[model samples]
Each structure stands twice: as C-alpha cells, then as structure tokens.
Target: MPRSIRRRPGLAAALALLAAAAPAATAQQVVIYRCTDASGALTVQNDEPCPAGSREERAIIEPPPPMPVYVPQAPAPAPVTSRATQAAAATTPAVPERPEAPAPARIADADRLPPPPIFRCHTPGNDRYISEDAEPKPRCVPLQTVGINGDPSLGAGAACEWQYDRCERIPDGEACDGWRQRGREIESTWRYARGDARAPLQDAFARVSTILSDTTCGLPPG
Candidate 1:
C-alpha cells in the first residue's frame, strides 16, 4: 500500500490544490449597512447585508388583484293591447239615453171647478158686467117679458145682451209673469165694490182670477 501511494503522489498533490481553490471560488462576499434606531443606538451587520444588531428588511412586493367587470341588463318589453282598429273605432256612434215622461196634472173637486168660458170686455151704448158670483138682487127688475142672451146684438126690450171682445193685451199678462195683471185689478175693484172688506179672501180671489183669466182668455188670438 505504501508503494501504491508513492506512485499516485502527483495526483494526490493536484487534488489538494483543487480543494484549496474550491474554497476561494465559492466564498461569498458580504455587504454591510449601518443605521441608528429610535433609541439613538447605532447598528451594523453582515450576512444578508444588514447593520450590526439589526435585522435585514426584505421587500414584500406583490401584484394587485384583478378588477371586476360589469355587464348591462336589457329592460323588459311593454304589453300590447288587441282592441278595435282605429278607423272603425272612430266611426262608431255613441248610444243616446231616452228622456223621462212628464207627470200628469191632478184635478180637484168638480163641483168647485171654474166654467170654461170667461168674461170679455166690449163697449156698446148700454153696458152690462156680469160676474159668476152674482146673486138675484131684490131691486133688479126681473122683467117677465124681457130676455137675456149670450149675443152681441142688444135687442129691443132685452133685459141683458152679452158682448164678446178681446181683452186688452196687458204686458206680462199674455204670458203669466206673476200677479201683476188687468184682470186682477178689475177683480180687486169689484171685490171692494161688493162691500166684502175681508182682505185675505179678496187677495186670494184676485190671484185665482188672474190665473184663470190667463189660462182661458190668454188664448184669444195671441
């Protein structure tokens, strides 16, 4: 074994030289930093290139997270109606409502009803005014030979002859416009002449007479 080692001496020497060179080639160089802390203490360090008695600070760099993308939604459609067409709809007629009938007039007592014919006014040589309320006068000469008739001619020896003429066309009397009328005036005068001093009855009679005259005689020509 001694003789074999003596034979490999050159190789052994070269191996030793490689070992020494390997350490020199692989030796890491270090950079150092020095700084002062909040406590006013100085520090310096080696290894990761930091100040002594201080830890090396490494950068914690990281990429930002991805951003969010929004997608737009479409609005819902409106409903459609299947009604009548425009031209036919426009030409269609609207229905009319029927009118209501008027109520019938009510009649009171038949016995107290006024006569159909009313008195008229006309001037002749001798004039006679007759009222429906006239009574048989004790002094009125009821001549047995004389006669009274509804006529215009005043016959000889005639007791009474009725004359017919259109009553005066009084304003507001042609169409009843309340109480102001000629017939009412004449009635009020006659009521006073009869010595009936009852005011309310006289006024009532006047109003009724005015109404009746307008209803019956108002149809005379106009």
Candidate 2:
C-alpha cells in the first residue's frame, strides 16, 4: 500500500504529459500547404500562413465514416386455431342435395309368334308340291325356311329362278309376255343393286304375284 501510493504521483504526471501532448499531435496533423516564393521556389509546411499569396495549395486528409451493420429479424409465427374453432367449422350446414337422375327408358318386349311349318308333299304323278302347310299325305315332309343372307349371288340366282317359274305358270302368250316384261324390268334394276336384300326380294315377289293371281288354283286370298 505504501509503494502504490508512492507510484500514484508518477502515474498522474504521465497522464498530464499525455493530455498536453494530445493538442500538440492534433496541431501537427492539420492540413499542409505548398507555397511558391518570389523566386518561384516551392516550400511545403504544416498549418502556416502562405507568404503574401505567391500561390498556396492545402491538402486535408480525413478518414471515411464506418459502414453500418444490419441484422435480419426472424418472421413471426402463424396463430394456432383453437379446438372450439375447429368444432364450429365442423358444425356448418350440410351441402345442398343433388337432383336425382332421370330413370332409363323402358323397352317394350318384341311381339313374338311361332314360325309356321313348311312341308314338302309328293303327288301320285311324280310331281312334287312344296307347301307351307302340314299335308296329311304319306310323302309329305317338313322343310325349314331357306336363309339367303349368306350369299347375295345365290339370292339373285334364286330370284331369277323364281321369275322363270312364274313365267312357266302363266299362259305362253301376251300374259306371259307381261310377266317376261316385268322380269326384264326387274333385271334392269339388278344393275343398280347396292348389296341389299330389297332388290332381289322385290324381283322374287313380283314373279310370285302372277302365280298367286291365278284363281283356278283355288289358293286362299293373297
């Protein structure tokens, strides 16, 4: 304690010297000037007045200000929803009812009939009669209706054959000529046929009409 107290005065003296030296250092650091003399000789000095303005240049150096530092803050957290809010959302009104779709159209069942039996009957004169009715004769046999949908060529040939049969049935004169002319007319339509059943069916029925027209055969009303 005694030695520390003795050193205090020396420390105080040193601090006083530093304080006095501060102003002297500041004065030394002032702007410097370059002055030209009467003989055009240049002289450089610190903080002194130029001699009668022969020419003077002063340079002051100062340090630039320090840049400011920026620190980014974190974003605030999102608010949490309470359980009551979730329950209220769940209790909202139910969605509007959707309209019912229209019922599908009801389809009517097809009107059905049993197919008529076709019979083949033979006469005593060795002639054969193909009938659509059930003949009680011993030589009569049932036959199925022929389907001509498979081959269009076969259908056309059958149509021509039916026409010839009709021509044979008619009297061999102007009446048969009429039937022949009808055949020729129907044959002309064959050129325009477009792979349909109508043309051949039409020709076959036209021939069948002559046979059905004969009243002497005692056939039922066509």
Candidate 3:
C-alpha cells in the first residue's frame, strides 16, 4: 500500500486520543474582539462574540519586543601635558620677598635728664666743670657759663658788685638812665617768662634792680 494511505489510520487514531484527552481546549483558549455598535461606538472585549447590530473588526496577537540592554561606555583618557610646557613651568623664577624695615632706635631714660649746670674758671690753668658750688678758687675766677640755666649772671655776684661800684662812680645823668632803662627792660621781659627756667630770669632781673638801687640809679615806674 502507498505511504499516505498507510498513515491515515494512525493519524486519525492520534487525533481521536488528543480530542478525548483535551475536551475543554476551546473553552480554555482566549480570544479578543474589536466591535462597533449601532451608534458607531467602538468596544474591545475578551472571549465574547460581537453583538447583533455591531460589526467585528480584525484582531491580532503579537509577541512583545525584547527588552533593551544598557551598555556602559569606556571612561575618557586623562589630558596629557607636553614636555616643553612642563619644562617652561619648571624653569619659571619665583618672586623675591621684600626686606623687612629695621626697628627704630630706643631712647635711653638717662638721655632725657636735664642738662647739668656748667662752671668755668678764667685762670690760665683752670678747667671748667659742672658744679653748683661757686666758691672762689686759688688763682681762679669762678664763672657760671652762659645759657646753662638761662641766666648768665648766676654765680657772678662779684662781677655784679663791681658793676654796681662803677655805676656809683658815674653821676646821675643819661648814663644812669641807661642802667635804669636796662633794669626796666629786664623786668618787662621777665613778666612773660614761662617754664622751669622762668624763675632764673626773674632772679636775674631782681639782681639787676638791686644793683641799680644800690648805686642810686633811678627805678622805672610800675
């Protein structure tokens, strides 16, 4: 017998066994339908036939597309510096720092003390010294230096007495007026005197007045 005729009975027997084993295959299958109603409203349904006045539209079953795969790109390479550029940077000179200023000189406390009174001797071998004592030395005339205490007449009592004697010798005239005028001028300048040296000037003016008074020279009006 031909091969087709011989396989017919076996194929029919296999189909019969499958139908018997799976009687509810049609009920288990899912079908989706798209339909339009009388009012032209479209509806989609699962496992239900279209209504009497509605038309059925074609439906299809499609496999879902594959999920996308994420690919990580390689990291960018680091920037490269040329040898010439690196050499230029290495050869650059750093700025020089400024020199600091020297500190100011400090003033000594001893330097601020008042100057000592100066004494001198007019004798050929006598040397000057700073002392307050004005006693006459042997063969030496004691003299107070000028501008030491702003009074040149200080420590010169002998000289002042000698001047007074000379004034006594002169008759009372323009000569006597000159001496009186000098005393008045000294007195006038003393009125405006100030500071620690002021007392010495005042004392000097008093000495001048006393000399004039002793010699009978006229005194200026107050």
Candidate 4:
C-alpha cells in the first residue's frame, strides 16, 4: 500500500504550483518517490523530480493557501507645534453660550406589524371601493339630471337622497393577498403611469410598502 506523505512548507508550495499548472482534466493523482534523502535516512521524498524505479501514484494532496507576508507599517510622524502664541483664545467679556436648538422631532415610519385593517366599501349605485375607515358616514347625492330643454335648473323636480355605502372588513389573509398583489402591480406600472394616475398609485404603494417592511407579513421571505 502506498502511503500519503505530508511535506514541509517549501514542498507544499512547490506542489501547489505544479498542480496549478496541471490540466484541470488531470485526475487528482501525483507520483510519490520512496527513497533516501541526501542525509542517507530512509524517507519518502516529495521534492524528487523523477522516480528512480517502480513509481507509486498517490492521490494529490491539497496545499494550504499561501500565507500573507505582513510588513509592519511605519509609525506616523509627530505633528509639529508652533509656540508663537500660547495665549487662551481672546475672550469676549460678555459672551454667553447659545442654547442648542431642540433636536427636530423624529418622525417614525408606520412599521406596525399585522398592518392596519383595510375595508371594502360601496356607495348607493353599487359603485364599490375599499377603505381603511371602519364606519364611514353617508353622503348626499343629487337625484335630478339635466332637463330636456337644456335649462339645467330643476324648479319642481329637484331632489336629493343620502347614500349609505356598504362596508365590511375583509379577511386578513385576503387583505394580505391583495396588498402584495397590488404592490407587484404598482411596480409593474411604475414605468408607464404618468401625471394624475401616478399620484394615487404612489399613495396606495405607500400603504402596501409599510406592510412589505414587516417580516411577519411573509413578503420577501426570510
């Protein structure tokens, strides 16, 4: 049985260079020479350039990475001081230290987890919409339309009714699904949306983004 030989640093470095030059397709094999060193001691030598007789091919040993040679950095030069005038900074007799302006109040981002609830709402004519408000008050709607004569003034037919929009808190799962979906949609449309259309999307994106920042929302997975 051929034994694997652990060599010195010099040998290891040489082997590493030789292995690097070898074709990548070469099998992880190296020829090992068993012989006597110049000292005449029985030993397995790795530095031998060639085998004298029957050669043993052993698995190539991986060499450690080269150790970095560190040269100690020179100490910095000492700064020269001028003794021209060592007097205390000229003092203004009545000078008073100005009070530091109170630090500007820190505004916190809405990073609350399990985001605030979103509600689905609709006003009279089955016109549906979503809202964050729980109990929204009804609004007045003019029931009259333009007159046949184009006069537009409704003398006797003028009427109005209070429209109560229906609303319900959607499931958390459903709300979260919609929030993530809307975020993706907003990102998709970001390049195209312009002027008026972009403003509302910006607001909507802000709400969705708040949830996106929370890891518990399961977005952008850990």
* C-alpha local distance difference test of each model: 0.39, 0.43, 0.46, 0.57
For 1-222, candidate 4 gives per-residue lDDT tens digits of 344444545556657766574544442444445544434433444645434443443334544444456789999997755554323333335342221222322334343357567677777677766666767887887876656776567445767788788888878867776556656666556546766876676666665666655534544444
lDDT string for model 1 (138-208, tens) is 23333334225744453455363444332332233333422323345555454445344445445555555
Candidate 2: segments with Cα more than 4 A from true spot = 1-29, 63-222
Which residue pairs clash within candidate 1?
A: 44-51, 44-52, 45-51, 45-52
Superposition error at 60 for model 3 (Å): 99
User: Quick one: best TM-score, which candidate?
Assistant: 4
Q: Which candidate, 2 or 4, would have the higher TM-score against the true structure?
A: 4
Candidate with the greatest lDDT versus the true structure: 4
Q: After superposition, how far is residue 65 of candidate 2 from its true place, in Å?
A: 8.5
Over 4 Å off in model 1, which ranges? 1-115, 118-127, 133-196, 200-204, 207-214
- Candidate 3's TM-score: 0.21
Q: Going through the candidates in order, what is the number of backbone clashes in each?
A: 4, 0, 0, 0
Task: Give lDDT: candidate 2, residue 155.
Answer: 40
Name the TM-score of candidate 4: 0.34
lDDT of 2 by residue, 1-222 (tens): 111111223435544544455544242334556677666676665446577956788876332333445789999998899999889889986542222223322322232222223334445455543333343424334323344676434443222111111112323223333433444444445445555744564655454343323322212224
Superposed on all Cα atoms, model 1 deviates from the true structure by an RMSD in Å of: 36.7
